[model samples]
Target: MGADHAERVAHRVSGARLVAVSDADAARAGDLAARFPGVRAVTDPLALVADDDVDAVVVASPGAAHEEQVLACLEAGKHVLCEKPLTMDGESSLRVVRAERAAGRPLVQLGFMRRFDPEYARLKAVLDSGRLGRMLLLHNTHRNKSVPDTFRSEMIVRDSLVHEVDVARFLFGEEITEVTVYSPAPTSAAAEGVVDPQVSVFRMQGGAVVTNEVFVTNQVGYEVRCEAVCERGSAMAGRPWADLYTTVAADDGEGLWGGGVPADFLGRFARAYDLELQAWADASRRGEVVGPTTWDGYAATVVCEAGMRSLTTGEPASVTLVDPGPAS
Candidate 1:
């Protein structure tokens, strides 16, 4: 994601310039820098964050590293766009939230790219227009090509389903109040002990119930879909992208329905990424932070932890939150 964002800012996004990049591997950073003349390559992001030349920071580092990095950037007063799961848990994310509040203005924009996706934006507009009447239920389906060897059972919610977590918030304009996970038997396509297909129920503050069904090793394609059921009618999104793509279909039941899905997420949400970065860049240039905030990141972590606990406890869990107040 770090590399992806750097490319977008360098070439695609307007008003954004890629000045420097850092990676754990200095060579990798240098290689990325080689693509753009005058872009500095660094071995440490902390140095980049503190550089006076760097007016803003993009935290595409792994979730564990996010807490300190995001805090450092904010303390240095650099505008930031941090990728989701926001600090791996609620407490760390909350600290960032408080820090942003202490700064007296929003400074961070979370990377919940679905908010910028054309299909999702249209769906949200319909819901907001009351054309869908009152949104009653939202059904979310996330089917991935496969999971990596390092992927674990918990990632089903922490990583994949996390998108839907943020999406539900974006569409309904409300926070999730409760979440429950139902993990069935692991699929053969999944990592040995990992749970492949899981279902989660998320209850929002506005009486909307969302059922998110995630399949990481669907062996089909990369597909994400959502349907909003309302008083007047129901609407859906997530048609396969027009770009070149494929999926897996073995001699089995689930695989039997497999066909063309996006080859990867980038091709699927390319425009969304561009729009999100463009918005962030435009806002940062204006001395403001907009789009998803630190509070939204904090909320996502809270819901994920609750769902993980539910997976073990076999019971519904309530989502808890710190009052975001004005910073949100």
Candidate 2:
């Protein structure tokens, strides 16, 4: 994701230019810098953040490093686009939120790129139009072909389902108050000790409901789908309308359905990622944040922490979060 964001900023985004990038792997940073002329390579993330030539920051470091780097950027008075799990836990996320609040403006845009996706944008518009009446329930599913070997069962909530957590908050226009996670039987294809698929339910403060099923080893392909059940009507997102299924049937009329699914995250969210970077860069240039704010990132971390606790305790876990202040 760090590399992807760099590519977008260096080339795709209009007002953005990659001034410098850092990686724990110095060689990797050098390679990326080589790809983009005039972009410098910094061995340490802090050095990147402190670079005088850099106008803004993009926090894509690993989860543990996010808190320090993001806070440092805020302290440096640079706009940032921090990737998900602003920190591994809610406390650290709150620190970032507090820093943003103290700054008296939104300078951090949480990388909930789904919010920028065309389908998701349309869905949000539909919900906002009051045509949906009041949203009662939302059903979301995130499926992937597989995860890396290091992936564990807990990632079903903390990683995969976390996206839906943010989406619910974004679409419902409320905070998630509670979370409950239920694990079904693991499939044969699941990695050892890992629950390949899990369900997470969220209760919103506005009395809305959200359920997310995370399947990281569907052994099929990458796909994300969401549907909302509202008082007046329903809206769905992420379905590919350009699907073309070839028929292989015998004279007896027996047939098989076949089509392609997204091979990876980039395939599914290429446009969203691009648009998100463009929006982030444009907003940063204007000294404003027009995307998901730091508060949204903190809310997601709080919800994900509760979901992880519930995933193990097998009980509904309450979410506790600090208000990022109305003026923030």
Go through the candidates in order and give the C-alpha RMSD of each one to the true structure.
Answer: 3.7, 2.1
Model 2 clash number? 0
TM-score of 1: 0.92
lDDT of each: 0.87, 0.87
Candidate 2 residue lDDT tens string, 1-328: 8998888887788976788989999999999889988888999888778888888998888889989999888888998888887899888888888888887777898889999999999999999999879999999989999888688987778777889998998898889999999889988888888877898889999988898888888888998989999998899998644454455676788886666788888999999999998888888889989878877888888888898889889999999887656554
Model 1: how far residue 316 lies from native, Å: 0.7
Model 1 has an lDDT value of: 0.87
Residue pairs clashing, model 1: none
TM-scores for all candidates: the values are: 0.92, 0.94
Error of 1 at 39 (Å): 1.0
Name model 2 segments beyond 4 Å from true. 240-255, 324-328
Model 1 misplaced stretches (Cα beyond 4 Å): 240-259, 324-328
lDDT of 1 by residue, 32-100 (tens): 999987899988889999998899988988899999999888889889999987898898888889888
